[model samples]
Target: MPGSGRLVDVVDTTTRDGNQSLWGATGLTANEILAIAPTMEQVGFHALDFTSSTHMSVSVRFHREDPWELIRLMRAAMPRTLLNFITTGMRFIAWQPCDEEVMRLAFRCVVRNGIRRFQFAEPANDPSALRRVARMAREEGVEEIVVGLTYSISPVHTHAYYAERVAALADCPDIDRFYLKDPGGLLTTDAVRELGPHFAATGRTVELHSHCTIGLAPLAYMEGLKVGFDVLHTAVGPAGNGTSQPTAESTLRNLAAEGYEHDLDPEALGRVSTYFRELVREKRLPPGEPREYDAAYYHHQLPGGMVTTTQRMLEEIRRPELFDAVLAEVVRVRAEMGYPILVTPVSQLVAYQATRNVIDSERWLNVSDETVRYFLGHYGDFAAPPDPDVADRVLSLPKVGKLREAEPIGLEGVRARFGRRISDEELLLRLTMPEEQVDAMRAEPAIAERSVPVDAGDRAPLVRLLREIERRRQISYLRVQKGDDLVVWRRAS
Candidate 1:
């Protein structure tokens, strides 16, 4: 990730945040993690974000066996890869870190385990929480601390506010590096541009943890580079798709095109992309695309190019037509507020770059001169510079204001809508919600029923696919109502 004498360290999170949404459907094994380790190294990523020991029971067990042992093994396996970890935190990492002593235990996991670096996704709105976490990291002698912006949760907040919160942490004697964590999968390059100066002001170096939820990670990262981020978080292609982050391939390619000397090998990136794609494809998974290529991919494959979350929504919701309505409502709200309601920055870029391809897109694009300049900084010379077109077309894109503001749903409703078999992660992602939302999603029958069904062409494909999924045993059949139609024995598996 070293580019132009500026050592831009890259963190490859393909198996971690990059696969958060996919974890429900597919949990990579130790071998799977190991297999991709080389791919990461091949791609010239400075390091692999490794795994979150705090995520699940299996991962915890893996951590307990001596992280050093595992790191040593991975190190031996992919000697070139930098293995890192995010020990424990507020979210899925529900480790028994009941007290401050637990913090020491987490720290030991890093140093004793050959884990050179570590991070915790510090939500921007929660400065107190971030400071506490940062203080602990510093106390533990942790080499580097990446402060995650966790951008998606508080989209309503401004760039200045986030910078202020992160900047405050910069002075914390215990920390080394800072970062922006765009966990909600909603980050944009332009947003990064607006953010870089604030982080740079901190005097401490800053890093960025972006996502490809709406696919602008590469661009966001590039913007961060223009503003000068010391490190950039990324992943291999395709696996770095929706719910993932900007891919190493695209980021490197962008840097390369700009005539930067990336210390990591570009050929290695290509190899890793191929390696990752084959595995994902074999896993019966979808391919991840770089935001840089999303416009091309979106133009070439709109129906398939849609994010997994949106596709899941299509499958779980009742009113097939409601998607359009939901998007329209989103557009109406965004237009009313004066911007395109893009899920992320790249989604806006793709919309601006490929108008006819995005779904009912034209109405939501509210691109402005400022946005086009940002695009130019990231995408380089456009045969047709998107700046003016972006400004002209920004309002033309569609929005999802209604869906974004949707209230918590219920469980019996969950049983009816997505079926009782829906994994907690899938349910949360599809609903654009949290685990607690599941409790609500199960309570109301109508709310659940209001969702789209996980439809297959017929019972045969459905049954076979269900059986293939390990969760088939967890599902329960139920009834659902859609307009004048009601169906019984409706299965979620």
Candidate 2:
């Protein structure tokens, strides 16, 4: 009712978050994304939740494509729309924390590559870290900086807790807005009603980014709109729903029903959706579907990606029956470790510990090196004090001293280790990834043309075969014969 006359903005997450959610972040290649770029530009999104540092690393490791080129090409194709880059604020592509100079260089490279909007979250929700990163992004010439108030369900993550964070950030001039990031899809309508006002009171623009993992995001979006959230993050077609964000089509329909206005063109949105739907069918990738409410998901509070990863790990180990038990163990592990918001490294750490607990005879017997680092305060301060017994046991480990003495590799050291003659983009990749992976990426041929195959209906198999032949550059000619029918194609060269 409060948003009756308001024009809501939309951030399209199809390329980044949706891809990660539905396809493990390797769904779209530069060629495929570029083909749809012109259409996406016509959709009137406030920003494209385009890429994160992790996605950039993924591009090099999986697609062997230049991520900087991808960003540059997308910017040229969609000059009117803002391309956003999200990060953890503590690290770049690598999991280990980097020196300030390294982060500064990373930000410089990111902004230089045409990322106008910068969004980041400190895993621990540390206000000081948020402020520091916001300053860094601003200094690097990022036009917009959005801080994520990561949402989680814990005794320590109350309204008061978030309100203090909001208050702390109120004085920061560099931060443009606050994004209520519910990565776990744990935000309910009631939670929005409660937390929305605090963010609104910040006098900064507020955006809502939630997943449809547990079927709560759509409901939460409506409630968020009612409570002064100015922007909603959504995806299109196969990229939306299920574990991804709410579908743009459905969210827009709901917005119209509530008498809210937005700038999105329905025809343009449909075209984008159609492209993705076809792509999903062609690639044989899993399409995002609407999820049913699951109460157990709220208990474990693992993000969508973690749940899938854990299931796959358990199945691989031939212990698929232990899936539910692992989920249960996650709750205890999360509490013992102080209720980290289920995102990136923290979520992975918690899930790893949970799986180990379920598999091993003892709970803390097989702690990961990262877990040891986390408990030692390498990540950031814990939201609350961890279980004293568990913390003591973890701290007493022999490797703690070595981990404590380890320093983040400096930017100068990285450049020296890699070559000084290489470009900053190449240097950044080499800094975080293994040299062999970078070498493999370099060895791969560039994507010079659109690789997405056109749908051929009943003849799709034949078309696929032809496309495969085209990919094998060595094949200059092809012939096919069946019964009395014969078909032949030859390359011009």
Q: What does candidate 2's lDDT look like per residue over 383-406, in tens digits?
A: 888999999998898898898787
Candidate 1's displacement at residue 344, Å, is 18
Candidate 1: stretches off by over 4 Å? 1-7, 22-27, 36-39, 54-72, 78-80, 87-92, 95-97, 152-156, 290-493
Models, CA RMSD each: 15.9, 3.5
Model 2: residues >4 Å from true position, as ranges?
Answer: 315-318, 449-493
| Pairs with steric clashes in candidate 2 | none
* Number of the predicted model whose lDDT against the real structure is largest: 2
Model 2 RMSD vs true structure: 3.5
List, in order, the clash count of every candidate structure: 44, 0
TM-score of each: 0.56, 0.92
lDDT on C-alpha atoms for all candidate structures:
0.52, 0.88
